[model samples]
Every structure is written in structure tokens, then in C-alpha cells.
Target: MFKGKFRIVAVICFVLFGVMAYLSSQMSFGPRDKILPGIYVLNVKLSRMDRDQAIQAMKKMEASFKQARTIQYRELSWSLPMDQVGLRLNYEEEVERAMSFGRTGSLWQQFLERREAHRSVHLKPEIHLDANLLEKTVTAAAETIILPPRDAGLIINDNDTVEISPGREGRLVDINHLQQELIKSLLTDSRSPIPLKLVVAPPVRSTEEVSAMGINRLLAMYSTQFDPNKVNRAYNVSVAAAALDGLTVAPREVMSFNEVVGPRSTEAGYKTAPIIVNNELVDGLGGGVCQVSTTLYNAVLLANLEVVERTNHSMPITYVPIGRDATVVFDAIDFKFRNNTDYWLYIQSHVKGGTLVIKIFGNEQFKKDVVIRSWIEETYNPDTLVENDYSIRMGDRLIKQKGAQGYRVSAERVVMEKGQVVKVEKLPTSVYKARNQIISQGMAPPGDILSNPELPADDSPVNGEMEEAEER
Candidate 1:
């Protein structure tokens, strides 16, 4: 009977302990209600607090920490604001951790903790940072500290001498390393401004390298004049000349006119001007660029450079004689030459006072005296063809166009050494076809008394005047 009584008392005690533990979890606490002793969050006491009270206490502590933190760079310092860099805390996870101080574990274990309040629990809030905000901050700081390297340059003097300029080094932030430092700052609450790492950037080339190219001494030069009155044509001529300036060609390199000059279009700054099309004068784009090519062609010939490729215009141009003109049509036609010397060659071109000049420079051994010569080998006069138009008045004569004689012309390149002709190289011949004169004569009135029935003789006044300079 005594043993039975002890069992009943033990059952009652177990039931009472279960009810108290359930009530602890359900019941709310007042502002003054104390949490179990020995509970701390990041060294701040969170004991003797309810759920809401514990959260508020942590918020106040966080504010104070952020207010005192600063990131310093030299004399400049930036405040560590929770809002600016999107600093965030896992509030739910941290609060749950704090609340679990004595609430967790087996029934007996929990009861034991509450019985004496002897256990100590310490925890830190889980922190996070917005990725985009961190990236932006680091990138902005990088821009301020980064410097780009400057490449070496060339300066052409008034006397056609070239000078070299030194290049400069630059410093740039190492992004990967900077990002790593930023992560540490966010995770560890590090307030010190992180020192940035940099890499040394060297220029593409140095002054000493450019100076060793050996682009000196005038090998050959040529200049041609144009009418500045033609505004668009003159502008195109200037544009083409400017493109060829300061061009450097290595030894045995072939320089192409089309490649260097590029396309001749309105987008490329060429304007409409008179150009030869199908052996007839017509307004077209890049009209005056040919003059630039022709001028350069003569200069290259005078330099005794190897002519890799060249072609003349269909007919003679007024600026250069028949076989001397070099006509280019972008990708279709081109003028090219090779730098056959052992050293580098430089081409300098400019437009001044209505003249376009092209100068080729190389080593002294490449210099030569070159003379150009042209002569007509064969000539012929074409028969003048006449046309009749009813619009002309009766007995009134009109000459629509004057005729031009056809000729086959030959050009020679004369190379001289010490006042004696070393070689006479015959160039390609140019053939020009004659354009006939067109005459229009009006018809007489039908059966009129003023109209003479007999036609005029071959030596009549109208026919005799045309034969004054007859060759045959």
C-alpha cells in the first residue's frame, strides 16, 4: 500500500512539471519581466527580456555600432551606414537563437536550466550585404584611382624630320583583390578603409624603339597644282593628302593606295566633283582623290621604288600628261608600290596653297636622280561627223563641237647617276580616241522662190571656211 501511494505522488509531480513548461512557451512577458540569467548577444546582455523586448534591444545596439564605425582612406573617411551599403541582419534567425537559450533540450535538461539559471549562451547576428551595392561602391573607388597608359607618339617637323615621344606608365586597381577585401569588411565589421592593390601598365611602344626605325633623308618628292576655286574637289584633294601623311612602311612591304586611302564616299569626306567616266567628263564622288594618287605615283617613281601595281586613266588628264596619271576607284582600281630598301620608308603628304605634295623618305642609299619624259609616237585626225536639226534657221550654219586628234603616246623613266643617264625605262603607252565635231543645218521652205534649185559647190563660202586647216 505504501509503494502504491508513492507512485501516485510521482505521477502528480510529472503532470505539474509538464503544465509549467507548456505555460512558459505560451505566456507573454511584461516589459520588466526578466529572462533567464547568463544570456548574451555579441557581448550585450539579452537576459530578462521577452521576444519583442529582445529584438528592440538588439536594434538599439546595432545602431550604436554603425554610428561609431568609419572607413578611412588617407584623410578621407566614409561613415559605415547600414542603409548606404545595404547592410542587413537575419533578424528572425538571430532572435530565434537568442530565445532558444534555455527553451531547447530534453524536458529534464530544460527544467534543470530553469531551476538554477546557471547556463550561459552567447551568439552573433547573421549579417549580409547587397551584392549590387558592394560592386558599385568598389567600382567608383577604382575609377578615381585608375590611370591609363599613354602610347608613344611621333612629331613631324616643318623640314620633314620625324621626332619620337616617350610613352608613360599607368596604375589600375586589381578588381579581384579589392572585392576580396570588401567581403572581409562586411563580414567582420572591419571599419578600416582597405588598401587597394595595383598593377603596372606599360605602353605599347617606347621612344627608343621608334627612334631605331631609321626613317630619315628625302628619297624623292613631287608636287602638283589644282584649282582651289572648285571647293568640293579641293576639299577631297586635301582629305586624300592628309590620309597619306605620316605613313610608315617596313622594308619589302607593299603599300596600296586603296588600302591606305580607304573608300571614297560621302561618309569618308569625299564630295561631288568632275571625274572621268567611260572616257567622258562627269560629276562624281572622289573626283579629286585621283590627283593625290597621281602626285604620289610620280613621287614613288622618282624614288626608284618598285611599282607593284599601277593603272592610268582611260584618257589624258590636264594636270598630268597621258601616261603619267594614276586613276583609282577604291577596291576596283589601285596604285601600289613596294619599299625595296633595307630600312623603313615614310610617306609625307600635305596640301598647301592649291598644291598637293607627296614626299617619300628613306635611307641615303635609296636616293636617286629620276627624270620623267613623254612623247607622241603616233597621231591621227578623225573625220568630222555632222548632224542636221530642223530647229536651225535656213542658210544658218552652226558648229556643235570642235574635233580633237587621236594619238598614241609613250612615256620614259630616265634614271641618271653623276650627270649620265644610267637607264631609260619605257613606260606603258596611252591611246586617246578623237571626238568628232557635230554640225546642225536647217531645212529650206518647200518650193519657195528664195530657195535655189542647184546645190552649192564644194568650195562655197560655208564649205571653204572649214577646210582652212585641212591636213590632207
Candidate 2:
């Protein structure tokens, strides 16, 4: 009876333990998992609970997530515009209240506590732009503008009565004034993209106008003196035209003859060979161009212009006097003169009937009475000759003689005022080499010398008489 009673109690205890295990397996805590009541033990499996709890938990989590997101935005609120300042502050306040409730462990926290909470969230950034404000700021900065004064009068005037007036004078526009105008225009309306127009006034004519004129006046002054056709005919097309063309001379400036002429090549139609460096004679592009420089040198001197630089030729030239010639070789050589007068000078070039002339016209105040003269310092006559004879024993027989030595000459320039010497300048010296004199061997002897001993003896007496007369 005791054994049967113990077996019945054990089976009852086993059934109770099985029922508790099945109940525990059917229980659900969140929306993703749920427990069903009275389900068979072997059939019990996990199931979706009323998502309202899970969803409610999620909703609480979402609210908590939004509060956390608001806190993050508040931290970054300083970067927002003025208009969003109040909005950002209000959102920060709501987040602070939510965090307070979360700390208290209220119903909202309980729902959130049922599941894992979201740790991160993303928020959109805002940008603000005001086109009108930008435009107003730009326009205010650009309100005031300054412009350069415009050029007003005639540049070249040909109509005249008494003296031959070349065309109107050329003028230089003030570069500073132009630059200021450009700056003002740029600052006024940066977006307008309109370029400021520069108005350069034509030259004015006053008593001072005569000096302001350039080479044009010089050319016109002497135009009537020469026949242009004849002057042109003398120059190679390239050199001649450049010579006749008016030159530009700035105030108190020096002009270079070769620099203005540039290079004379076949391309430039300069058929003659140019005088090269060190006054060495070489066949080059510009040959006869030196004539132009030489002519200008004379003109500058005649005008009483100050000579800044001038060099003589390696050899004497036929066109100008020995001391008056100016040689130029591009940058290496130059005939330069300064415009000492206060007024501008005009250079006019032209050819007239086999002559090349350059004229300089400026104020008379700067003009001076200038004169240049030169003479040979000394003359040397080295009439000595040396002879050499080689005999048949030393290969071929021959005779040789060296020629006479040449002379060295120096010259000077003198400036005069009111018949009084003001300044004197020493010119360069030149030395010529002697030529070699050679006499061939086996030449015919003089028959007169062999035929007359008395004539030879008489020749010495005659030479002696000539020498005595010279001494007396």
C-alpha cells in the first residue's frame, strides 16, 4: 500500500513540473516574441506578441531617440542662423524634459527599457542666402567713382600762313591719370564688367607748343629744302624710308640712331653690308644705314643739341668731315643726343636731291651757338724699306722688301659763345698701318747704271748739292 501511494505522488509531481515548463516556454515579453496560455508542451513555440506593446515600446524609444537627437542638434545650434535660434532653443528644452523623465524611470522609460535604445540619429543641415542684401552691400561700396580728364584739342594742325608748319604736334597722355580712372571704374561695379574708356586729348598749341612738337616739326622745317624723290633714290628702300620717317623724342630724353633704325636685313630690304662691332668691315644686312646716322649727327650739331654719345668710323668717310662722322652698330654703337631744352623736340627726316637731312625743332631758349673744328696733330712719313735676298743654296732664290709705315692723327672739338670759347672736347685718334712692299727676284737691271760710271759718280755730287741747298 505504501509503495503504490509513493508512485502516485511521483507521477503527480512530474505532471506539475511539465506544466510549469510549458507555461514558461509560452510566455512572451516583447513584440518579437510571445507566450500562448494552455498550449501543448511538445507544440509550444515562439510567436509574435501584440505588437502594440512592442510598438508602444518602440514609440517610447522613438520619443527618447528624438529627445537624444534634439540634444545633439542643440550642441550644434551655434552654427545655425538667427532665425533658427529660438527653434533650436525650444527643441533643447523638450529634450531636457524627456531626459528628466528617463532619469525618473517612468512609464516612458519602462517602455524603452523593454528593448535596446537607438544610439545614433541623423539631422538635416540648413542654409540661408539673401541676394538683396548682398547686392546692397556691393552697390554701397561702389557708389562713388572717379574718372580721368578727357583729351580736348587738335593733335595735328596743318593750316597756317607765314612759316612752314608741319602737321599738328603729337602729345603724351598722362599714364597716372589713366591708371586712376581705371581703378575707380573697377571699384564702382565689379559685376558690370564694363571697361573704362580712356580719352586722350589732342595736343594744344601755344608759344610752348612749338617745343612740344616732335620730329614732325623738324621734318616740316626742312622739307622745302630737299627734293624727297632724290633723297629716296639715294637710300636703299629700307634705310631711306626709315631715315625720312619722323622720329619720336621725349622730354629731356636722349635718342639712339641705330636703335630707332632697328636691324637691316634682306627681310627688311637692306641690300648693303652693315658696319659691325669694333668698327670691323663685314658684309651684313644694313650697310648704307650709317649714312642716316651720320646725317642726323650733323643735324643735331647744327641744332646745337647736346651730344650724349658719338663715335667716329674705323676709316674716314666721304659724306661728312673727318671729325664730324657718327658711326652706329645697333646696341654696340649709337649716335645719341639729349634734348636739353625744356620743351619737346620733333624729329623729321627726309631725302632731298642726293642729300639726307634730319631736323630738330624745339624752343629757342635751349639753343646755343656751337662750333666744331678739327686738325691733324702731326704727320709721319716713314719712307724706309727693308729687302731680303735668298741664295740658290737655300732652295729657290728670291728677294723681298717691306713698305713704309703710316701716320697717326688726332682731332678736337671747340664750343663757342659770343666769339668766346666755352668748352673743348678731344676727339678720338686714328693710326694707319704701313703697306708691305715686295719686289720679285730675277728682274731686269737698269742698263743706264752699267753703261755710265761717270753718270753714277755725278749722281752723288748732284745729291750732295741738293742736300747743301736744303741745309742752307
> How close to the true structure is residue 300 of candidate 2, measured as C-alpha lDDT?
73
Tens digits of per-residue lDDT, candidate 2, 76-181, equal 2111121211212233332332233212365444334322212212121121223344223322332233222332222333431113243343332233443333
Candidate 1: tens digits of C-alpha lDDT, residues 47-105: 77777777788777656444434444456555434455455566556767766655668
Candidate number with greatest TM-score: 1
CA lDDT, every prediction?
0.70, 0.43
Sequence-dependent TM-score of model 2: 0.41
TM per prediction: 0.61, 0.41
Error of 2 at 120 (Å): 42
